[model samples]
Target chain A: MRNNDGNLVFERTPYISGYASVVGKKEGEGPLRDYYDRIIHDSYAGKDTFEQAESELMNTAVRVALNKGEFTQHDIDLACCGDLLNQCVASSFAMRSYAIPYAGVYGACSTMALSMILSATAIESGAAKRAVCAASSHYCTAERQYRFPLEYGSQRPPTAQWTVTGSGACILEKAGDSHNLLNHHTELKSNIPPSSGDDPLLKENHRESQTPYLHSARLGRIIDFQITDQNNMGAAMAPAVVKIGIKNNGIKHGIKP
Target chain B: MRNNDGNLVFERTPYISGYASVVGKKEGEGPLRDYYDRIIHDSYAGKDTFEQAESELMNTAVRVALNKGEFTQHDIDLACCGDLLNQCVASSFAMRSYAIPYAGVYGACSTMALSMILSATAIESGAAKRAVCAASSHYCTAERQYRFPLEYGSQRPPTAQWTVTGSGACILEKAGDSHNLLNHHTELKSNIPPSSGDDPLLKENHRESQTPYLHSARLGRIIDFQITDQNNMGAAMAPAVVKIGIKNNGIKHGIKP
Candidate 1:
């Protein structure tokens, strides 16, 4: 087992096999636009309110990621995820329909990283065979809760960021030795015939590609330089982000930042 | 390596070595009154605002728990804790004075349980030598955020329980076996002399009492039964709490609920 203790990086044996991103039309119009699995026409996505729409994004994103991984809902051991909602209603409400176990986390905009770290550790420690890390945020929902209501039409300050209306999910499966990054979860029996058998997905011709590995994860500690500016979250998150990036860089690539 | 996988209970070896709670005057006069270690004169705790008072309570609780454990700040690896505050500012701001790492968490009223579980798991997994699990809530802080300000004096239905202005913390130490519940952290050595030596604290006559072990921890999945009553958090939380208690009972004692 990889040592996942007493350090920033959770060096675990988890392979990120499949992923999906569901974005709003505005995000679909942006760069890296073609990469998203699906994009809805509006923020509401036919829901009555922005919160419902956010939940829809999360639910759809999970399904899309599962489809990409060729795994069904029953195959996933748990959904370790969160969002920007108070009480994390977006993820919790979406989870009521899902039969799998759930773990709701909160880390503001950095919640996805937190989810990924938790899933990796859980899977590494044999708490799960597979886990889905998901997060979502809608412009309307976040604005009204954290700042001004849509009806107020408050002007955005220069440091203000437009809350992205999008959701992303990724399936992390337990991995094995370094020589075989393609090693899947032991419990998840494979469909790949044999190393020598006729299978184009794993054939010698298609073996050039790489499996995305969770080399290590640097869990972030809370940090604040006392920037009490309510309008500028960037200032508050800057120190923590910088610390994470520096530590992760050193762990992942033997270089001290 | 006790198995903490798939099952709700984290059957780790952590003993709840120490704990501390600080509450406002109103809570001090209530049911769990005798349980808390310290009760402030007012909600503000002589601070300028309710937020500051809440932070002071958290900071004081950590110190109290540490003192009870006879461990200093440097001995703690992390503080796995949070509060009902937005962005978990109460926990984060309170932790800044201590040099140890902080893990901010949120589970509404169930935050204390979350803090305990996380600290236990981290300790069992060897991520921490010593951990402090903490949580707090002030009536004024939560009321204004989730409902009306205190000045409004909104009439409450019987079902609407008053938000307790209180904070609680616990120190979970890894237990070696059934016999070693009182064994402290490895780093916290030398303070305790041998049982056969000249220390009256560990004399045979005074060894009857046992420290309660955290036999297991069951993480509760979110269960929203479509009751969207903002004022009735008790209603929203009842299902989750019941689910947790039943599962924990089964896992810890095999009594099927």
Candidate 2:
């Protein structure tokens, strides 16, 4: 999982069992579409005619988290998540379904980062052996609550940005010396999912580049506890790119290139 | 409003602009049922499809509060209410209809008492001039979330109580000087409304008495402060009747009458 930089790198352990995501798509649409549609339909328990979509999105995140592991609702010690909406509805209501002891968190755009940090701490401190951290946002839903809606067709300046239109959930287990095997009981050999016709890498790279500082803060380690340094920053490097590119080209022209 | 005992008392305030309530019925169900219904349905923005019976119950309580004129939302700078259900959907969602900013609170039976104490402190500290504290417990809804449904006919012990099926909203205003003309617009009307032809009081005895206390460590002649102490302890007391009842009844009667 590590790059050549000799720095610590993290990866999803292959031994972790059971991962499934419920998605809806018309054709050539992104996974976010399924999340967006569900927000309009149901939050949890498959009930319709409910108005708040925020609750549904969080439920989906939790559902995805639960399905990916052997742990059931009873096994969960705590659940945590955050959202961009003014009220922390996503995290609070999601816990309703699991009925596991939980706490709601608020960290705005930095929510995912906050949840991950807390989740790691919980596992490390033995407060919880397994913890789930999730975060979700819908551009249309959050905008309506926090700002103008897309239907408003408002103009945007260079400073204006779009909110991420997806939710993510992760399950963290305390790493131990003993190996735990992942079991797949199904024998029918379900299709290997055809490697998804679309490219996930492209989408992630495009989105991550938009908020490089957030990405780095989310993925990086501390140089010191007091301050964060976003090395190989994405969005932060956008402005200086052209100047660096031109300078490099000029140097190359004077040399071998 | 102040009683001869020098304690501030709150009358229920309904959503209706002006109306009185009949006892034994819901608050807004008197002459202004139509008006009150509109507010309830609109308050949650049709997000929660309350049963006709439930809607009627909510309206009745609002009607009672409105008719009493013992409180006004305008007089309230803060509000707190919640129930046994997850996420406190009833109280928090109901708040969107009103412009007053509020914090929804949760504590099984202690919700109302806790809100009153919190609200009183906000006003006494000069942080706010008025406040509202509300609580509602819907038996059917709460049963589904917290325990077996009525269909289960589950056996219960004497210590268990059915969740109350009513919502109550109260407004607390800072007392004004007798000559202060500004008091007229906010003063609680003296007329008391009847509670008939409205939603039945699920249980009339559910209304517990609350005694307001202002604990001050220093000599400040504030309403709830005692003069004997030398510390400025700025806090209000909403009676812990249930807590006190247990001790007082046991000590005085040695058993229940």
lDDT of 1 by residue, B1-257 (tens): 23344453343445666788899898788898888899897879899989889999999998898888777876777687778877677887788787666666777887887777666656544456567889989989888778877879987677766777878877776443222244443322434321212234333222434555554555666677767787787788778666756664465567777
Chain A only TM-scores, each candidate in turn: 0.83, 0.53
C-alpha DockQ of every model: 0.27, 0.01
Which candidate leads in TM-score? 1
Tens-digit lDDT string for candidate 2 (B92-196): 445544444444444445556545544443343233445555666665665655566666997666555545455665554443311221333224223323221
Candidate achieving the largest lDDT: 1
Which pairs of residues collide in candidate 1?
B13-B175
Against the unseen true structure, what C-alpha lDDT does each candidate score?
0.70, 0.41
Q: What is the per-residue lDDT of model 1 for residues A17-65, given as tens digits with 9 covering 90 to 100?
A: 6789999988999998999999997878899999999999999999898
lDDT string for model 2 (A58-135, tens) is 677567667656557655554556665533555555555564434344434556655654444333323444566777
TM-score value, chain A, candidate 2: 0.53
Cα displacement (Å) at residue B130, model 1: 2.8
